[model samples]
Target chain A: ELKVEQNPLFLSMQEGKNYTIYCNYSTTSDRLYWYRQDPGKSLESLFVLLSNGAVKQEGRLMASLDTKARLSTLHITAAVHDLSATYFCAVDPYNAGNMLTFGGGTRLMVKP
Target chain B: SAVISQKPSRDICQRGTSLTIQCQVDSQVTMMFWYRQQPGQSLTLIATANQGSEATYESGFVIDKFPISRPNLTFSTLTVSNMSPEDSSIYLCSVGRTDTQYFGPGTRLTVL
Candidate 1:
């Protein structure tokens, strides 16, 4: 069975602080994706890590994948209140099908 | 990335009722997926709606409970039958193209 686990299901951070969310999958995957969901809003596509050692950055957020280790990370640098939301990491194990298995989201709250 | 529009942005319904959510894509896509996000929980994939065929449901999800239809490559619908409070959630529609999935603004359902 394929399982995805995320650490620190709930996070509270002060403004300008840095934190990282970790995602570990039980099986090898072809690609990994990161998404952000605001309160009562739809999900926003964050990063698509397609290969091992792939790294992507947008604004203060960065995502990386280590396919060999079956792990992915979403790093927040200099967090702001607007960046507070639930982040989810999803894995697409089969390269043929686009079905994504998502991890339990990490809810982050950034305070000023 | 394809722009997906989901109808009935939100709806409040009584118990034992049913609701059908529609998703329309701006471009043709072979794979359209439906997902459900419960309050404070991660997303669970309901099914993969393929054009010209029946939807493929995931484990713990049945075709009867969440019936889906895809008459073409750019449109699909998911109907939740006999809904209860337990069915209250955000129903999201997504399309996969070139190995990346883009989401639509979800339909928020509240079963009273």
Candidate 2:
């Protein structure tokens, strides 16, 4: 079974601060995805990291994948209050045909 | 990216009752997935709904508890049977497009 683990499950940071969420998988996989979900809303796609060393950035959030190490990272640079939400990283196991195993998720709280 | 929609955005039901959630995509998709997210938790794959075939459920889930129907490529439905307070969660449907998957708005089910 493929397992995905994320660190700092609960993050509390002030606005303008920076933080990074790490996603580590137990199996070898090349496709990783990051999603954000509000308290009562569904998930919103954040980034899709497909290859080793692949990196994507949107606004103050940056996500990168290291397939060789079976790890991915979502870095938040100069966060804002609106960035406070639960972040999840999902891994698609090899030949799984898009079946995703998601991490525990990191709940971010950005205080103004 | 495929646009998806779910009916009955949120509902409150009594224990032992059943609820059917509908998922529709704007375009035909080969792979549609059902996921459940408990409060303050990450998303868990419930099953894979493929057109013209029986749904593939993940471990810890069964067709008797959550029956899924894929009548066509653009539509699917999930019926939660014998609901209980433990079943209260957000149910989301997603479709695979190209290399990425898009999620629906989600249906929140609250069992009393």
lDDT by residue for model 2 (A1-112), tens:
8889999899999999999999999998889999998888887888888889999999999999999999899999999999999999999996343788999999999999
Clashes, model 1 = 0
TM-score of chain A of each: 0.97, 0.96
Q: Which ten residues in a row have the lowest lDDT in candidate 1 chain A?
A: A92-101
Candidate 2 lDDT score at position A93: 91
Once fitted onto the true fold, the runs of candidate 2 whose alpha carbons sit more than 4 angstroms away are: A95-97
**CAPRI tier of model 1:** medium
Q: Per-residue CA lDDT of candidate 2, range B1-112, in tens?
A: 7789999899999999999999999988888999998987888999999899999999999999999999999999999999999999999999877777789999999999
Individual DockQ of the candidates? 0.71, 0.68
Query: What is the Cα-based lDDT of residue A108 in candidate 2?
Result: 96
Question: What's the C-alpha lDDT at position A1 in model 2?
Answer: 83
Q: What local lDDT score does residue B69 receive in model 2, on the 0 to 100 scale?
A: 99
Runs in model 1 deviating more than 4 A are none
